[model samples]
Target: MNGIKNAVFTDKSIRLLGKNQYTFNVESGSTRTEIKQWVELFFGVKVIAMNSHRLPIKVKGRRVRSIKGHKKHYKRMIITLQPGYSIPPLRKKRKELELKNTK
Candidate 1:
């Protein structure tokens, strides 16, 4: 089983696509080294570097008569791959859309 989930496709992540970096949501306890290894093994690409961010849990609503809890916290990893290796799903959909537009 894979320890890391699919790459995140948020606006920020999309912006980083051209730089050959991708983002994925990983288990909270996963370490940076583990993430790097998973990226390399799963994608069959060399991971140049990796950085992880722990998302802050947001406090919800007002103290009185409102939903009272923090949002789920998770870790996000940004992995930069070696030159010439790209995560296909990220660009694959885009290329297809472009091709459709040109037709």
Candidate 2:
């Protein structure tokens, strides 16, 4: 897969942060080992475990005769890091979001 695309920060993911887990949206072709290496190298965190899931394709605008189109499917990874390790980008985004919310 192409490099780590982006991180997911939904309500569910936010709750997982308390347990030292992070969610990232990755290319469909990426492997678990690749994700582990990338996270360790980029975030300076020790990845203990990783789980990947493929989201189902979303179909829209169905016609009477046939289907219209479908949104592309994507892979997501949930990474569990060793205690005391945290990703700076994730923290920065969270802080920015909090500031936005407060204002």
Candidate 3:
């Protein structure tokens, strides 16, 4: 569980959802096996395949030009689940709330 940071939702990721693939931000040091195990145990879904890659580190600095640091690096994991299984969409609740407020 600690290895997984959070679910990732983006234009590309949302499209992958239709294919039963889920994306997540994981700790940079986490391996595919570790992430697969954690996701399966926590979500109770069967993971068929896992693909992971590290995202590029971003540089950050203060306006003073003297202080600079690199943002925390993380890995992105794409997990494909067995047919007929799925994790709930994270944006569903937010969309519902937004619709309610707009009405």
lDDT, each prediction: 0.75, 0.79, 0.78
Task: For model 1, state the Cα shift of residue 100 in Å.
Answer: 11
Q: Indicate the worst ten consecutive residues by lDDT in candidate 2.
A: 58-67
Each prediction's TM-score versus the true structure: 0.75, 0.77, 0.73
Candidate 3, 55-91: lDDT as tens digits? 6553453233222464456878899999988887654
Q: Report the C-alpha lDDT of model 1 over 1-103, residue by residue, as the tens digit.
A: 2568656877677668779888889887778888788778877899988888876543453343323564434588888988999978778865665567679
Off by over 4 Å in 1: 61-73, 94-103
Error of 3 at 57 (Å): 3.6
Candidate 3 — which pairs collide?
none
Supply every candidate's count of residue pairs whose N, Cα or C atoms clash at under 3 angstroms: 0, 0, 0
Residues forming the 10-long window of minimal summed lDDT in candidate 3:
58-67
Error of 3 at 38 (Å): 0.6
Kindly provide the TM-score of model 2 when superposed on the true structure, using C-alpha atoms: 0.77
Better candidate by TM-score, 2 or 3: 2
**Cα deviation of 22 in candidate 1 (Å)?**
0.1
